[model samples]
Target: MKILVCIKQVPQKDAPLKLNAAGTWIHEDVSYEVNEPDAYALEEALRQKEKHGGEVVVLTAGPARAQQVLREALAKGADRAIHLEDEKFVQLDSANTARAIHAAIAQESFDLIVTGLQSDDFGAAQTGVLLAEILGIPHATIIIGIEKTDTGLRLKRELEAGHYQHIETTMPALLTIQSGINKLRYATLIGIKQAKMKPVRKVTWADVESKISPNLQQIVRLYVPEKQKRTEMMEGPAPEVARKVVDYLRTAARVI
Candidate 1:
């Protein structure tokens, strides 16, 4: 079983974010780490490889610093990694990103391709489906669990309204794993040392021929949502205050 896990480098959730001068995306001045959910996908891939006896190859697309996240994945037990580095790809939408991945994966046959349901920064859960379409493979999203069967792969998917669906797919498929699917493990000292020697393959968008051209839907002007605060006073005794609170919930807060 050859498993390919797609990962991404993203700003830490708690990291202070500031929009750029053009108000397009966050300013890059602080440190970054692997996207949280992608880590779970990596962990699941490694677990699958350990059980099934195969290689887990990690892949990411970003600038040079993206290599840091790739190394971190290597330390976590990925056999190797591919860094898809290109400046033109920095602002590319999910369609273009999936195109690049499809171009790269076309060269290598893989039994399974795994990725996080979405990136933390973008939260566009479209890549896996698009890549599957490009690769012509079955795909599943928001997968919380996976079990390998003699005939194919069994997966549990999280749906709206807290529902779950179990589905099965044959080999050469794609899956986008949801976060919290499994516990993430830290890199051990031995693993860290081993990662330094692991092979990290670097590729660029120009290196592969794009089978499809990118049709950009829209140029995003990223901006942080403005923060505002307000306070209101309730008059009268406890009962009146409670009534006011209920009114607030019913009208302003909309919780009721």
Candidate 2:
């Protein structure tokens, strides 16, 4: 089994964020880390490889800083890494991002492809589904568990309200993994040293530019909401106060 895990680098959860001067996006001069959910996806892929005896390849599309996540994946036991280097990746919507990923790996023969349920930054939750559609493969989202069967693969999907459904699908399938599917392994000292020697193939934007389409969506503005406080006091008879409160809610607050 050759499993490919798609990971992404995102701003650290607690990092302070500021919108750029143009108000088009967040400033990029902040700390970044492997997207939390994508880490779980990588962990699941490593477990699958350990059980099935095959190679686990980590893939990511981003600027140079994105290599950090790939290196981390290599240190955790991925056989190799593929870096889709492009500065524009930071602005591309999920559709164009999926198209670039497909262009990079479409020639490779992978039995299974895995990605996080959604990216931490965009939270669009559409890349894996779009990738599956671009590749013409079966896919399942919010997968909580996976099992290898003699005929194909069995997957446990998470549904709303704590429900789960199990389904079987053939190989060459794409899956968007939910976090906490398994325990994440730390990189041992030896693994860290070995990762430096692992192969990291780079695919430049020029290689896939033709395949990528213009972003279907773009951020128009990003800004923190202003905080405001207001107080309303009503002093009257019981019936009058109740009516006034209802009117305030219905007209001023517009919450009724």
Among the numbered candidates, top lDDT falls to 2
Which stretches of candidate 2 lie above 4 Å from their native place? 231-256
lDDT of 1: 0.88
The CA lDDT at 87 in model 1 is 55
TM-score, prediction 1 = 0.89
Q: Whole-model lDDT, candidate 2?
A: 0.93
lDDT of 1 by residue, 1-256 (tens): 8999999998887889888888767777877989888899999999999899999999998889889989999998999999888756667778878988887767799999999999988788898899999888999999999999998899999999999999999988999999999999999999999999999988886775355366566556875667788788899999989999999999999999
C-alpha root-mean-square deviation, each candidate: 2.9, 2.2
What TM-score does candidate 2 get on C-alpha atoms?
Answer: 0.92
Clashes of each: 0, 0
